[model samples]
Target: MRMLLNIRIPHEPFNAFVRDGTIEEVMAKIPEAMKPEAAYFTEQSGGRGAILVINPDEPSQTPAFAEPWFLTFNADCEFRVVLLPEDLQKAGLEMLGSKWK
Candidate 1:
């Protein structure tokens, strides 16, 4: 399944790493672990943040993807299932909705 990963890095250790010039070293390792289909770096709540689109081999594999962020950056991570237009078309929602009605 396709998953969206939102990583929110707290100010303390992340800012310290930035000031000490080690932020790049930390960032380089992060993507290597996930091999994200798409990745974006931006700020959230005045802190470092990232949004990653990933396809894990299995649902059980999510923890492995999140561990690096937690151990390295003390990041607050969230995972959400997502679908593309094709996926919605495949979902047969109209049939289910009619049954419910």
Candidate 2:
């Protein structure tokens, strides 16, 4: 399944890395390691943020993704299951709605 990885990096820690000139290396290294299908960076109200669409084989694999951010930047990471348009169509929503109704 495809999952969305929402990462929030706090300003203080992120700024420290920037000042130390480690941000470029650290930032580049993560995506290289994870090899996400898609990755995007943006700013969140709390700090810097990223949204990554990745495929992890099992539940045990969450740490493999989240730990890097946690230990590196004291970041917060959230994972949510995502469905493609085809996946939604195959979900049998109409069948479920009729069953429930």
Candidate 3:
């Protein structure tokens, strides 16, 4: 399944990384290692943030995707399952809703 990884980096270690110039290396390496479908960097709640789209083969692989960011930047990571248009069509939402109703 596809997943959206909401990553929020706090200022402390992140700012230090940016200052020392390790952030450049990290930015290049981590994303390359993860091979995310997409990566968008932004600010969230007054802090550095990123949204990474990844498709992990197993739930157990979550840590593989999140750990480096957490360890390197003291980031907070949240994972949410996401559906593409085809996935939504496959979900049979109408049937489920009718049955539940």
Candidate 4:
């Protein structure tokens, strides 16, 4: 089944992932956002912004709030994986299994 793995990593780690191509591997065949990598938007005053990783195949025609930059993941089924910043390393290790170096 296809899945969307949403991960939250520290700014440094996120940059490293992009540099090392880990992000590419995770999203499989999909297009990433342009510059500024991370997008931010506020729903209300004093509200924190969110980072969004979208699935390319699941397109929505309607206009929506902007923020949490959009990333498209080409997958066949619907799935969600949410990981916190601290769990990135462990989660990556698990995804790659023992063969990952």
Candidate 5:
């Protein structure tokens, strides 16, 4: 079964993760922005899995922009972790793994 986990990360830590390729590595690949406020998609582990990063701060002035973004994983056992800008650092990999399992 696939699950979605919501988390928060501080700005600095979040940026650091992005810089070190942690986020990209976990998500499998880079995300593509479908709508300004929706979300982005990426493949994880050389296409073994996938991830979707939903930007809560996406533009919401229009209905079209209110849609939630998503990332699709082609693998059978897959999950998505949606991290808010504030909870990145507070949420660790172990915690996520436990929650997912």
Candidate 6:
């Protein structure tokens, strides 16, 4: 499944990491852990944030994808399943809607 990881880094740790220059070291590990198809960094809610798109082989891999960001930045993270247009087309929504009716 395609998953979106929303990461928000708190100010205290982010400031500390920046001061210590550990931010780059920590973030360099992200590719190895999440194997993200795409990633973007930006600001949100006046904090540092990132959006990562990844596909874990199984649900058990969730921790591996989330833990590094959590430990490094004390980040608040959310994982969401997302669909491509092809995935949406395969949902059988018409039949399900008719059944519900």
**Residue range 1-101, candidate 1, lDDT tens digits:** 99999999888788888999998988988898779999999999987899999999898999988999999888999999999999999999999999999
Clash pairs detected, candidate 1: none
- What is candidate 3's CA lDDT for residue 46? 88
In model 6, how many backbone clashes occur? 0
Residue pairs that clash (backbone atoms under 3 angstroms), model 2: none
Over 2-97, each residue of candidate 4 has an lDDT whose tens digit, in order, gives 123332333454456578878656443232432222334333233322344333333331112122223222211222544556767656676687
Lowest summed lDDT across 10 adjacent residues in model 1 is found at 25-34
Off by over 4 Å in 3: none
The TM-score values for the models, in the order shown, are 0.94, 0.94, 0.96, 0.20, 0.20, 0.92
lDDT of each: 0.92, 0.92, 0.94, 0.36, 0.37, 0.87
Give candidate 3's error at residue 10 in angstroms.
0.5
Q: Number of clashing residue pairs in every model?
A: 0, 0, 0, 2, 11, 0
Q: Which has the greatest TM-score?
A: 3
By summed lDDT, which 10 consecutive residues of candidate 5 come out lowest?
65-74
Runs off by more than 4 Å, candidate 6: none
Give a tens-digit lDDT track for model 5, residues 1-101.
11232222224444565788786663333223322233333444443222333333333422221122122221232235355656767668788999999
Query: lDDT per residue, candidate 6, 1-101, as tens digits?
Result: 89999999888787887798986877787766667999999998988899999998889998898888888778888999999999999999999999999
RMSD of each: 1.0, 1.0, 0.8, 16.8, 15.2, 1.2
Relative to the unseen true structure, what is the C-alpha lDDT of residue 76 in candidate 3, on a scale of 0 to 100?
95
Model 3 per-residue lDDT at 10? 90
lDDT of 6 at 69: 83
Best by lDDT: 3
- Score residue 97 of candidate 3 by CA lDDT: 100
